[model samples]
Target: MNIFADFEDRVRKAVEAILKARETALPDLSRVAVEPPRDASHGDLATNAAMVLAKPLGVKPRELATEIAARLARDPDVATPEVAGPGFINLRLEPGFWTGHLAAILKAGGDYGRGRRTGHKVNVEYVSANPTGPMHVGHCRGAVVGDTIANIMAFAGDTVTREYYINDAGEQVNVLARSAFLRYREALGETIGEIPAGLYPGEYLTPVGEALKAEFSDRLLAMDEAEWLPHVRDRAIDAMMAMIRDDLKLLGIEHEEFFSERTLHADEGGKIAEAIEDLRGKGYIYQGTLPPPKGQAPEDWEDREQTLLRSTEVGDDQDRPLVKSDGRYTYFAADVAYFREKFERGFEEMVYILGADHGGYVKRLEAVAKAVSGGAAQIDVVLCQLVKLFRDGEPVRMSKRSGDFVTLAEVVEEVGRDPVRFMMLFRKSDAPLDFDFQKVTEQSKDNPVFYVQYAHARSAAIFRQAAEVGVRLPDFPTLDASVLAGLSDEGELALIRKLAEFPRLVKAAAEAKEPHRLAFYLYDLASAFHSQYNRGKDFPALRFVNSENGMITQARLALVRAVAVVLETGLGLIGADAPEEMR
Candidate 1:
């Protein structure tokens, strides 16, 4: 149902046919693209094919344009092919052509905008939240972005693996273990006062402490630090991960794999050790002294010999340390092993959705992917900026339970899940977002999620109203395609044109790795639908329901249904519900 794609194919064939007729060798035609003209008055579609192929064919663009235009004018679907502006081909499609595109939409239904199989296995790792506590508002953006990307890539026919890398092997989890132990002691009648500095102070872990007390009682109290730490740490991480999963569930996000950083050290044959050895074999591993990091005086920094990876050779800003002076693998080293594991499992395309704070980790991890896979795999990192929550115009109060940041559970419970998911995606991931509590909840057109949802609900309401008035929809297969062709009103044509852009929009968003583009497209489509609906208020004949003429009403209902189909598909891709009724 991609009208633009169909036109591009036709244009390519037309040019190739002309080349064959003239006995000229065809050059690469990949850059020859057909897109909608900027001004609707210009035409339905435009192509730069003549300009791109002219030099290769040894002719002026206008000469080739005349030949291509003549060939395309003969197409049954194309009403007129005119040469416009220095060899650009402007095509005006017959009204019947749009009806056929609409029929394609009905035939495909929810599968309307999906792409053909690309045969690429993609690993999308996001929300690698430390298994320290429940996910906070800060983690929500990356979670939604990553999950939406996985969904979009899958829609584009890529085998997508949604992954979460649990940071359970780090010092943060050790702090979590100690924090849980305090709660454990508190459960056993020891009054542990205000949480000490350098430890997690949230009250959420009080339950984790109570659970530990219920499971082991005083048995763990008798063990030495080294003996009890691992047990408590493992239990704490498991509980935190469970809490995090529950929070993610509230937003409809579920990862296919919860990869453990601890596994890199524990996996048979030591994956971290093997990864380092593999790099060393390639001469990428070396003992080196790094220049003191920027902004620090040389006297203030300690120069130490360390195991470093030749990350600069693979496009990193500088060589990165693989192992610290104390012999523990740096965080980057474990990331390398994890990437290698994914690459070995047959995924060459890796996408990481990280927060803005982790911007520095981008190039190093990309370098790791290239080095570990021997240039066979590459990583794309999307950095999500901060989200500021507002109630009307003022900032929302911080959660007392979360101590500093608001918890994802609180936001979901306060606003419900749909707003949280949709509003999070309402803006690009790299831009800072201000999510207003009152505005998103408002039923007016100011709220994008509400507007899109209402467009869907209105489409359903049209059917219900039509059925109430004893007007049943004609069977799609039995209906005359000419019924839809009668829709020649400016508003009707505008909506159909927007609907025709869905497949192209989906492919563009998926290829650009920007799920927010889909969200914006849905908003635009909703705006067009709303505008058309409003137009009927002033011009009664433009209304979707007409008792005097059931044929015209049925055709308009067909258009409404198509709008719902595309809206539902787009919302589903971004993990939001397309409600039949908005309460």
Candidate 2:
């Protein structure tokens, strides 16, 4: 029931009939598209059929537009089809069309905007924060963006797998192990003074230390560093990941897969060796020396030959190293193996939600997907920019729990999950976001989450008011267009049009891998609904409830219920809630 898609078919049919009557060969209709007009006042829907087909048909643009508009004007659902500037066709649908669609919305309810399954397996990897400490605010935007993208993708008909790559094999985890060892020593009654430099100072590790003391006691004390390091590191990673999971759960995020980096390095670098060998077989790997980076050479840049991936041949800026001069596999090697593993797992598309700082990895990652799958799979990288926290226009920094940065849990705790999740997505991910603690919690239209949720609350209140007036609304299953014929008001039809945009919005946002669009659409829908509600205040006949007339009241109630359904479905997709009552 996508009106735009439906009309696109109708417009194409009209063109085909016109061509048949003129004895003209048919032109490609794929380029033709039907969409909402940029300005609502122009018309309800706009199309470029005539403009796209005119050159091929050898007809004047305005002439073809006129012919198409005349045919569309014959449709019972179309009130008018006018030829606008540059041969675009603007259509205003009949009142029955809008009111009928409103009934369809109620019948569909939660499933109204759901898409048909595409049978595409998409792997969305997001919020792969290192398992070294509790998740901080720096990871919040990517987390919410990734989770919401997964939600939208699933709703958009892709078989989406939510994944998190655990970065537990790096030197950072080793540092965490050593830091936890210090806490372990303190837990054993050893008067270790201040936390030494180059070690984590956050008290979150205190519990990890206590847990180790309870498990291994003084046994670790006698063991050499080499013998105790692995035991302590594994334990510390588990503790940190547990804390991280709890923090994510507070924001309603959970990954279906948590692929550990250690697995790739297991069996004495088994997976990495296989990945390198595969690349070598494909002639994508070779021993080479990379030129010094542009402008200046990094300190770690070595002039000696090293094992490298021919990434530049596949679109990377330069060939990337697979193994260092020291004979240890580089971090890029692990990434290559991880991608290969995902490819072998049968994913047709891989989506990476990364921080803005990782922009450099985009081309190289795309190269990896190309080489690993031989262009059989696609890769998309979404980068989220930094979020600056403020309170009443003043910057707020530092968290006692995380020592230097604010923890994700702290942000969610301070403002609640709904505000944190909605506001995180209120802006495009590529743009920097300024999150104000006080502003998001305000119970006014200035607060987007509150405003949207308040719309749902108001809808609920409308039903209660209808009930008090002795107007028993018809059940959705029994409601039909006949009951909705009273909804001929311009504002009511406008609200219905906004609701009608949901399916198209969901499809577009999911295809673009931009969940922020959903937030924007929800806000727009809320504004339309609130405007209609306010209009009722000035015009008594425009009110949702008319105690003196039950028929129109039922029709209006159906419209309000449709709004509630859409608001709930959209909020759920973004990992937020739609409350029936704001208070």
Candidate with the greatest TM-score versus the true structure: 2
TM agreement with the true structure for every prediction: 0.95, 0.97
Q: After best superposition, candidate 2 residue 407: deviation in angstroms?
A: 1.2
lDDT of 1 by residue, 455-526 (tens): 999998988989999898876534678888778887888888889988888788777778899899999999
Model 2 ranges off by over 4 Å: 56-59, 296-300, 399-402
- Candidate 2's displacement at residue 18, Å, is 2.7
Model 2: per-residue lDDT, tens digit, 1-583? 7888899999999999998998888888999999999999999999999899889888889999999999999999999999999899999999999999998999999999999999999999999988878888889999999999999999989999999999999888888999999999999999888877777889889999999999998999999999999999999999998898999999999889999999999998999999999999999999889888888775446799999999988999889988889888888899999999999999999999999999989999999999989999999999999999997788878653337778899899989999999999999999999999999999998999999999999999998888887888789746968989999899999999999999999999998999999999999999999999999999998999988788898899999999999999999999999998887
Weakest ten-residue segment in model 2 by summed lDDT: 396-405
Deviation from truth (RMSD, Å), model 1 = 2.3
Pull out the clashing pairs in model 2.
none
